[model samples]
Target: MTETLQSLALSIIELATFIFVFIFLAAIVWLIWAYISDIRQKKQAIRRNFPVIGRFRYFFEHLGEFFRQYFFAMDREELPFNRADRSWVYRSAKNVDNTVAFGSTRNISAAGEILFLNCPFPTLEADAVPPSAITFGEGQARQPYTTSSFFNISGMSYGAISKPAVQALSQGAAKAGIWMNTGEGGLSPFHLEGGADIVFQIGTAKYGVRDDQGQLSESRLRSVAAHEAVKMFEIKLSQGAKPGKGGILPAAKVTQEIADIRGIPVGHASISPNGHPEIKSVDDLLNMVHRVREITGKPTGFKFVLGAYGFLETMLKSIHERGLEFAPDFITIDSADGGTGAAPQSLIDYVGLPIKESLPLVVDKLIEYGLRDRIKVICSGKLITPASVAWALCTGADAIVSARGFMFSLGCIQALQCNKNTCPTGITTHDPDLQNGLDPTNKAERVAQYAQKMVHEVGVIAHSCGVREPRELRRYHAHIVGDNSFSTSLELLFPTRSVKPEYDKRK
Candidate 1:
């Protein structure tokens, strides 16, 4: 019996030894193959130089972003959006208590920092009223738009974001009683599904409203305007991210549905013209605006990023030469740091004016021209937080819009994969498997919560400033920090312009 037990143990030991030997041999073979492959590969210099050991560099590089976000980044240190900002949005979207425990981590004395002036006698909660409704194209268009929503969803094309993301935004916009810009991709059925007010954007390519030859089609324009949900039309002269460039959709993301909606060929990279081919001069822009408003009977406006201030003066002077009726219904000024799906590094970083300088410039120019009352100023570009929104109102923006804020509400991780088709959160990708992570019904609720929270918080700021509503906030109600570690009133920095006597008389 002792001999039999000893023999059984030896057999088991032999089997374990054989298995270990097999695995070691397989691993050695794999290492040799990898070493040869890395040495022979001409693509990567590190891999070719260091052979097998260099393969770890790519793996480490891929994992570095995650590590930094989770471990190394301070609350207020990240660019585009810091951890604190994203955390606030996440909490707001979840409809949880967003109140911070301790002191703010923000650098209050930093240059360009905006601080709201609190009044000794703040407005009582009962006295505070909702933002008054603002009318667009009041005597200019047959069907003018009037809405009380000052905070709105900005231009995010259906092709740039996933279908579920669009659906969620639309649904959320409706619930929050705000308008949704259909971006430059054109109006898809998904845009109409949530029953929200829509602003159809006309890109330089004239995508949805283009004819077979890629020219503006009056018939298509009429058809798009025929929808009751489409409240306005915005001619996108240039966006902030790539001021001199155009929209770019990767071929991989250009599915049949998106292609059909955008009036482009399927599986082809959709690149818009750098600028409107037909609308060359400022006169041509006004002409196009007049034609669109005439055909659609809806308010029409043009969006652009400010660069050369001289062109604006020229355009306003020409507006006076022509009739006031020829002027655009509204003007959307975008900031330089605006986000986009794709853009070249040079244009995205170096071109255009930031919203800090541009918003006040445009607003003062409008007031100077005596067109402030006629042209509603809607500003966008990183005005995601309540404080930023309040600052815009204080700086004279009639309304504010945000795109990345809504994307965050839809669960974007800022993975920087927007130009690629592999967005981890499914907000910007077309992959069905990735999109399955996003449920429109659920994210729609989050979207609504985020919008509602933003509006509510902005109201809180307004009340603190002793204003009855957000729109009542004036430039004097906020202060901007200067380089000398001192703060100056926004009113002093960008003083309100007095209207020219002749233009004021016309008004």
Candidate 2:
């Protein structure tokens, strides 16, 4: 019995030793293979120079993003949205106390930074009469949209965002009494599922309403407008992310359902024309708007990013030649610094004008032509915070919209993987496994809370400016810090009336 036990123990020891030796040999082989591969690689000089050890550079570089965001990057130091901006949105969405005890981390003297001038004797809460709701297409549409909420969701396409995200936005917007713009992707049942006010976007491709030959299909237009939820139609000429460029939906994202909604074939890269083939001249543009309105009987407007106002001046001149009644119901101006599902770096970086410059320009032009009352100016571009929204109200935006702020409310961490299919938070990805993480019912409340809080705070700013309502804010109420490191009232800088903008009163 003792001899048998000894033999068994020896066999077990030998097997363990063999396994260890094999593992060691395999590790050496992998190391040698990696070293050779790195040295042979020509794309990265560091990898070629230092072999396997240099591979650590990329690993560390990737990890550095998380490290910086969590530990090193200051509150005001990140791009697109700093930690401070994101944190505020998170807190507000969570409906937690978002007040700060310490002084602001903002660099007060940043060039062209806007500062609101508070009134000596502000309007009391008791005396404040809330701003009246602005109505669009009053005489133009069978159904006009009248909403008092100043801050609302901007255009984010159905395919660009996940099902849960749309569900949340829809329900949330409904709860907040705000509207949701259905980016050029077209209307989905989910968009109407939440029963929120819907703004159906008509892209350059004319996605939902296109015929077999890709022309405007009246039957499809009527079908979409038949829904009581769809309140308006916006003809998207260009977006801030890619002004002259078109929308690109990679082949992977065009699932059968999305293809059905967008009226495109499944599993193909859906590319919209760079410019609407039907829209060549200013007359053609208005004609398209008129056709959509006549067909859908809804407020029809066009969205675009401003480059130079030559085209705008021509359009206005044509409108005067036609009539004020011929003017489109509204104009949705997207700032150059806008968000998108996917955009070229060149266009995203340098193509369009930001809202600060473009919003005032479009508003001033409309005012110059005396069409301000006829066309509601809906401004979009990073106007997420109370101060930013208030600034737009003062500058002349009839309403403000934001995609990223609502994205944050939906628990987006700015993963920047929106174009990719692997968004960790599930807000932007179509992956079912990822979508499971977001509970639309719970997130919807957060969305509503964020919108309500934003409107309330803007009202606070209006009262501080000695105005009864947010719409009463004007250029004199806000000041911008200039290059000389001194503050100048926006009334002087982008003076609303100081410089006479050329206007051809054709009447």
Candidate 3:
């Protein structure tokens, strides 16, 4: 028995040695093959020189992008939106304590930094009145619209975002008492599912209410208006993302459902015309607005980014000649740096005036022409934060609309995959697996929280400015960093129009 046990141990040791030798020889052969392949490959010099070690460099570099964002980037370092900006939105949406301890982490020395001038005796919360409801298209429009919320959802199409995203926004808007603008892609079933006040958008393409020839279809317009949820119509001239350009939907993203809604062919590039073929001048635009409002019995407006001030001057002058009643109910001045699903790098980077500049410019012009009461100015660019919304109010914007902020509420990580169909958060993508991860019902609550928080905080800013309400906040309430490295009051820079209206005093 002792001899048999010894033999068993010896046999086990021998088998182990044999396996080790086999693995050693296989590894050596594989290394030799890799070395030869790397040396022969001329495409990569580092791989040729360092063999396997060089591969790790690329691996580490690939990981650095995420690492930088999560670990290395300071709160205010990132562009477009920094870590602090996104975190605020996330916390607000989750209804968490968003107040930061210690002082602000903002770089006040930075150019273009905005500062609010608080009154010594701020308005007490109890005495401050809430934002009052403002009516649009009052006398001219057969069915004018009214809403009190200053912050609202901007244009984001059902196709650009997902079905679940649209459903969530619609329900969230209804709960938050704000309106939702159905982007230029056209109205879809999800838009009306939540019984929310809807603003139907008419792109240059004429989309949902278009005939086979792409002309405005009175029948389709009437049908969409028939729904009690649809409240107003917006004629989109040019969005901020791509000025002098048109909306673009890649062939791959053109699902049959979206195509049907937009009256385009499936599996085809869904590109809108640069400008409406029928709109040769400002008169043509007014005519179109009148036609839509007449058919739908609703207030109608046009959205555009500010370009040549001369044209705006001409348009306003023309409106004056045509009568103030001919003016659009509202004008949406989109920021040049506005976000979009897809656009040429040239346009997205440097083609239009940002909201910071455009908002005041448009407002000043409207007030200059004495058309401020006739036309409401809805500013839509990057007015995401409470301070930003307050800034809009102080700078004379009647309403604020935000798209990216609401997207964040729906769990978007700014993956920048919106133009593609691989959005992992399920906010922008249509893939079944991704869509399953996003719960519309759960996200809807988050959306409502974000909107309500914005309303509340903006009111806080207005009260701090010693205003009775948000609309009362004026240019004197804010300051902009000047080129001379000093904070200059906006009232001094973009001073009140020489011919001020009596209402300005009350504000």
Candidate 4:
């Protein structure tokens, strides 16, 4: 027995030694190959100079973004959205208690900080009323749209986000009684599945409503308008993220379904024209609007990011010359800092006006031109939080829309992989394995909760300001922090311009 045991132990030891030797040889072979490859590579200077050792730099650099988000960054320090803002959205979506234990981490005295003026005698709960319903294209379109939802889900194309993400947003928007914009990708069946009011966007590409030659097809326009849920049509002159550019869907994301819906070829990168080819001048724009409204019998509007002020004045003047009936039902002003699936870094960072400067400018211009009552102003660009929504109402926006805000409700971690096909949370990716992480039914509930809570919190702000409802909020109800760390009334900074008496008389 002793002799047999010794022989077995020796055999086991020999097996272990052989395995280790094989692994060591394999490691050496891999290292030698990698070293040779790195030395020969001309694309990366660090790899060429340092060989295998420099490869770690790229790996470490990729890891740094994750490390900074989880550890090094402060609650209020992150860009696009800070940890505090994301945390609030998460809690709100989860329908959990979102109250902070101690003081706020926000820099209250920072320039551009918004401060609401609380009334000594705030509006009592007994006196507070729900937001009044605002109707679009009243007495004009055969089927006008009227909704009281103050905060709504903005345009996020089906192709830009995953199938489940669109499903969840549509379901949630229905439950929350808010409208969903079917972005520029066009209307898919998922958009209709939830029974929510839909706003079909007409991109420069013309997408779902385009003919075989990529021109606007009247038959397709009639078909889309035929859907009862499609409440309005928005002509996307330009999105905020790429003001002078167009929508870009990578070939990898352009699956058959998305391609069919967008009227583009499968597995091809879908890039829209920079601007509407047919609609060149302001007159052409109004003509297009009239054409769409006549065909669809729905509220028709155009969305654009503000840059040159002269065109706006020309557009408004032309509206007067033509008729109020020729004017757009709404004007959607997109902010410079808006989010998108893909855009050039230069356009995203430096091209257009941020919401802070642009919203008030557009609102005041509308009032000055006596079109404030005629044209409903819907502003979008990072107005995710309740305070920001309230500020927009005060600044004269009839409604506020958010895209990334809803994405957070759908469990986006801001991995910044939107342009890529590897979104970790499955909100922006088309990968079936990644998309499995998102259950449309479950995430839909979270979406509803986020929208409901946002509207509730904005109401809280409105009540605190002694207003009966959100729309009652005026510019004087809020203050903006100045460079001196002192605050000035928003009403003073952007003084309310009087409507021209001639146009006011027409109203």
CA shift at 208, candidate 4, in angstroms?
0.4
Q: What would the TM-scores of all predictions be? A: 0.95, 0.93, 0.89, 0.96
After superposition, the stretches of candidate 1 with alpha carbons farther than 4 Å from their true spots are 1-27
Model 1 weakest lDDT span, ten residues long: 498-507
Locate the minimum summed-lDDT window of 10 residues in model 2: 498-507
Among these predictions, the greatest TM-score belongs to 4
- Cα lDDT of all candidates, in order? 0.93, 0.89, 0.87, 0.94
**Candidate 4 lDDT by residue in tens digits, 1-507:** 999999999999999999999999999999999999998889999999999999999999999988999999999998789999999999999999989877989999999999999999999999999999999999778899999998999999998999999999999999999999999999999999999999999999999999999999999999999999999999999988899998999999999999999988999999999999999999999999989999999999999998987898898999999998889999999999997589999999999999989999988888888988889999999888999999999999999999999999999998999999999999889999999999999999999999999989999999999999999999999999999999999999999999888768556
When summed lDDT is taken over every stretch of 10 residues in candidate 4, the lowest stretch is: 498-507
Please, what are the lDDT tens digits per residue for candidate 3 over residues 433-482? 89999898999999999999888888888888888888898999999887
Clashes of 1: 0
Query: Which parts of model 2 are misplaced by more than 4 Å?
Result: 1-26, 41-43, 498-507
* Rank by lDDT (best first): 4, 1, 2, 3
Candidate 3, run of 10 with poorest lDDT: 498-507
C-alpha positional error of residue 441 in candidate 3 after TM-score superposition, expressed in Å: 0.8
- Which candidate model has the greater lDDT, 1 or 3? 1
lDDT of 1 by residue, 1-507 (tens): 999999999999999999999999999999999999999989999999999899999999999988888899999888788889988899999999999867889999999898999999999999999999999999999999999999999999998999999999999999999999999999999999999999999999898999999999999999999999999999999998899898998999999999999899999999999999999898999999999999999999999999988889988988989987889999999999996589998988999999999999999999998989899999999988999999999999999999999999988888989999999999889999999999999999999999999999999999999999999999999999999879999989999999998888554
As a whole number from 0 to 100, the lDDT of residue 304 in candidate 3 is 90
